[model samples]
Target: MKLYISLLLAAICCNWALAQSDPLTVATFNIRYDNPNDDPHTWDNRKDVVANLILFHEFDIFGIQEGLSHQVNDLDVRLPDHDFVGVGRDDGAEEGEYTAIFYNRTKFKVQESDTFWLAPETDHPNKGWDAALPRICTWAKITSVNAGQTFYVFNTHFDHRGVEARNQSARLILEKIEEINTESLPVILTGDFNVGQETEAYQLLRTAPGMKDTFDAAEIVYANNGTTNSFDITTSTERIIDHIFVSEKINVQKYGILTDTYHSRFPSDHFPVMAVVNW
Candidate 1:
């Protein structure tokens, strides 16, 4: 009986130590889709740079926008230790751009996952609220193997051309978050929102109950530049559209816009926004 008690205590302590050791590194990147018009910035040339950035930064999990099926497959192949959860936005299959969330398979287990359209008829794939294109939010309930803790992650890209679509999309995501997270677990939201901090849509998300933007909440910040470079490595705009937001329970430690470049060239049109958060 004494040996059993001692073993039980040791197991509890080990789990506690694992849970306390590290904060999760999360990022949101809009890896500009494969376009021949992009020329020097096409996926073939930029994929390696993007992969290197993620690997070097050691992002435990990240959300990517504007990645098509082939692009997603490229990342999946490049990051052999990681897997993603999402679907194409056009037909709920591999037919269009994806707002996919990728997690380190060695460190995390996906417990639940789904993709929902940001439309009035969310059950199907269709343009919503006068949007020029259909948009989607891909989410997952993931469990950290190291910490044995579970959290929810929501990743998305809002309609870039519609004012009403963006606003309503924000509301729809918030509703979905609340509806799905009945346990009120820690939530991390990442995306390329395509709107600056001053916009109403940005305000809606920032002001939402229990949600705090990591850029604003982090104790340390670096490379605090605008997220969009439009493939211009030298331009440093002050407006930031990419964002990472987390629940109040999560402690945001550091935030940054990863302005990594390769031979003076940007890997993508938008720089990734990253954060370190702990619960």
Candidate 2:
């Protein structure tokens, strides 16, 4: 009878741990850029590595920031089963960086997808406020194949040097969230904000009644906070500039930061953030 009770208690503990871990995995990665100046850490050298990382995690959905046309095209070749949506920030064509959102085509189907500039004239590729470049956000409405459930995913990269641009960008995204949500379905936002968690930009996004940082809301944040590491530093308390946010319709299960390194080489300058959620 003692042995039986011990087995039951172990089973209960296992079940509790499993319950804390999330099933649906989502990630956000800022792969720096394919600049020739960064020869040692060029995109060509790490694109396949990045693809393999995604495959290893088996993430259901993910967003990538600062991916160029060729970079995304390479991902398409590597991840043939995955479908992506986004446009270049320059001229609404494949001229500049793409904040692309990728999902497993086998698990989800795209209902609609588009790119909008984070500027006054959101219709075009105009730089808003004091932004250094014409920043843009890519969003998709996707439906789960088995459940037939629909949700929205937004991917973006905020201006690195413009404080006002970053704050305004948050407001613009908040408005977009409202405009996109008619069914009250789950909404996921992922990005490289170029700011820490305690800034105005973060506050603007948090102001949304339904939106919450996945890491903060998760039952277990396995990877901990401070997502980004500036390549040289092993760890720091205030380097986090990347994030993933989810609406109240979703329950965050687990959150983490990908800290894998191979041969002392990282896939990118910024570490990717991931989360598991129940929708």
Candidate 3:
């Protein structure tokens, strides 16, 4: 009996050590705007599925794009125990689609949060360089309760129509990253870029300034079929316009694209992407 007890204690210690090595999982999802025309696939029809996706995967930090005020509120009500940092792109309040940053409340303590428009009038809700509508980035500074590590998260959606606006928005975000990540703290930038990896904007994100694409830096890409699937239910893209970029401080263990469906319907038009990383 004493030998059995000692063996059990040793096994427990080994398991605890292995658990401590597990990487933090971060995800990026574009829940598709709440369009009234999307009748059968409207937010009401699939909000629960989307919420369940996050809960099932147990993401520590995630970014969302194209979420309106009511949509954001719905997720908050459904996926309780998580807090968000964001503002409406139209008026910096409960006005327009929000590119929000969400963190699991039980896993982290919020330090600071901010939102800035991607425009000349960045301090206000305004369009820039022919952008079809106002666009913005929501950010947060949070510390992990489990690991005691702190990092900055910036989430945004670039204009889908204007090429110049997209390029400039990339530059603008880079400048902000440099300013706020002054100490070169671990940083994460995720979004729906609406451009493929070949574009100048994506090239800048991939190369200059040391921000590593989680997919590129991962030691193992366990998943990653693709990131976007149109609402047609039959269409999907390998262009993978959406992405997650992490600072060099992170060691990416695995990268995946969550392509899940309920019955035959999808939770959103885009497949959520994720990265399992350790600092």
> Which candidate has the highest lDDT of all?
1
lDDT of 1 by residue, 1-279 (tens): 999999999999987876876689999999998999998788999998899899999999999999999999999999989999999998899999999999999999999999999999887899998899999999999999877899999999998999999999999999999999999999999999989999999999999999999988999999658999989875789899999999998999999998888889998999999999998
Ranking by TM-score: 1, 3, 2
In candidate 1, where is summed lDDT lowest over 10 consecutive residues?
14-23
Q: Could you tell me how far off, in angstroms, the CA of residue 267 lies in candidate 3 after the best superposition?
A: 0.6
Q: Give TM-scores for every candidate, taking all chains together and pairing residue i with residue i.
A: 0.94, 0.89, 0.91
For candidate 3, list the clashing residue pairs, or say none: none
RMSD of each: 2.2, 6.1, 4.6
Best by TM-score: 1
How many clashes does each candidate structure show, in the order listed? 0, 0, 0
Off by over 4 Å in 2: 1-22, 233-237
Locate the minimum summed-lDDT window of 10 residues in model 2: 230-239
What are the per-residue Cα lDDT tens digits for candidate 3 across 1-279? 999999999999987766556578888899999998987889999999999999999888899999999999999898788988898898888999999888889888879888998887789989999789898998888888866778899999999999999999999999998988777888988999888888998988888667889989999885545677776567666777889999987789988888898878889888898888887
Model 1 Cα displacement at 105 (Å)?
Answer: 0.5
**Residue 167 of model 1: what lDDT?**
96
Q: Write the per-residue lDDT of candidate 2 for residues 173-192, one digit (tens) a residue.
A: 99987897778778999999
State the local distance difference test value for candidate 3: 0.87
